[model samples]
Target: CRIQRGPYRCHEKTAGFNFNYTDDPNYGPFLVSVNGVAGNNTELTFWELLVQTGGNGTIIRPDVGIGCYIPEPNDRIILKFTEFVSGSHSVSGNSSNPGNLTAGNTSRLDSIELVVVNNISNTTNKTYSTDIAFRGVLIGAMRRLQTNSGFNFTYTDDPNYGPFLVSVNGVAGNNTEKTFWELLVQTGGNGTTIRPDVGIGCYIPKQNDRIILNFTKFTTNSASGSCTNPGVLLFLVGLFFCFLI
Candidate 1:
């Protein structure tokens, strides 16, 4: 959202060339969008390949998506927006709003157990099996819990970390103060407790994951993990530039 990726509309000097596209309300930017007239059954284009023409004029489409594609010097980027049409391939454009990300048929993962521990002693202050949502991230679960239930918590977006869990039950943490909240997961039906190998955005809960938002403090280099993966982090990261809501 801070124009760290590309086409930063903000007042920032050009570090390199970047492209601009609309942040449509219906579908995301990676899903192609059209402004003017379109056919009735037009669909959102799925960005196929991110062609990087090197100095030697060689093309490459990375195994990952455009959101996670890293750029190097002397690289030419070509974005191919394409879609399938009646057993044929065609250019991508705005056909209609993006399809339902999570269809209505999914009703299995309804709730999850959330254990809130304050400080190092790990005293369980609040515990409940809140409803699990299709938010696609841990932050979304917090937001949904706040609305569906009465769970109270606050967080800030770190340029490095996706969602900096600052305070829970009225406690806040900051970088300079060497204090921050950490996330821990209890696996195997809540028997074993271990820190997640990855950040919250990348880790999707597998039904019975006991999400523990622990309040802790860190020293000069302790709070090191901040998220950069754009696939799931885009929705929250873009808020720093301009939140849709």
Candidate 2:
């Protein structure tokens, strides 16, 4: 027959005896197992039983997780993980130089050079040293009026013109005066002196003309004016006005 009882502890020597068969104390023995393994009865206190069941193992504090152990600023960490695992992680912290974390785009050119070639005949060859940003490029002639003669002048884009202010070479009637004359000088027109009768005349000063072509205001990439202070053209104009009077 089966018997039921409240919690009870038996001494080690009598642990295997069936309490239900107390009347016939020696009638049968009880089977005992620890973690699903058959075992002979042995003496054990409650504390010992608890230890055998993993109660003494280290316990992780709830507040401290994997991230808590990371070192402070300037400490380097080498991380090796597969792409899938790495994708799950994120970084957050205050940096010494916060701007280093921001992403920006910048571009730089390889090499830049500015070249201005004057094709006029009378002016001397000149090469101006300038920064990369100021290089002006235009495929045309530079036209201006001679300060001395008040005659329209044409500065060629060819080597003959050299690099100088556009102006007439000399006085109009002088035999030696070779004026750098142009038929019609107008602003914003094709750099050409198109007088059909003169057949594109470029003033050639003869020897007798005492007047000289003066460079007043000269510039590229923008129109010439007092505000810009094209000193070369101003000089030319000053020389022409002085000679004309």
Q: Tell me, by TM-score, which candidate is best.
A: 1
In model 2, the runs with Cα more than 4 Å from the true position are 1-110, 129-245
Which candidate number would show the highest lDDT if scored against the true structure?
1
TM-score of each: 0.55, 0.12
Which residue runs does candidate 1 get wrong by more than 4 Å?
1-44, 48-79, 84-110, 120-123, 159-161, 188-191, 219-245
Compared with the true structure, all predictions reach lDDT values of 0.46, 0.20
Model 2: residue 4 alpha-carbon error in angstroms: 99
In candidate 1, what are the lDDT values of residues 1-245, reduced to their tens digit?
Answer: 23343221223444653444433221223323323322232453344444455567777654322322334555665555455353242222222222322333234344567877775655667886765554244555666677766577775544333334556767665434445566677874756877664444334455677887766654323222332222222333433221111
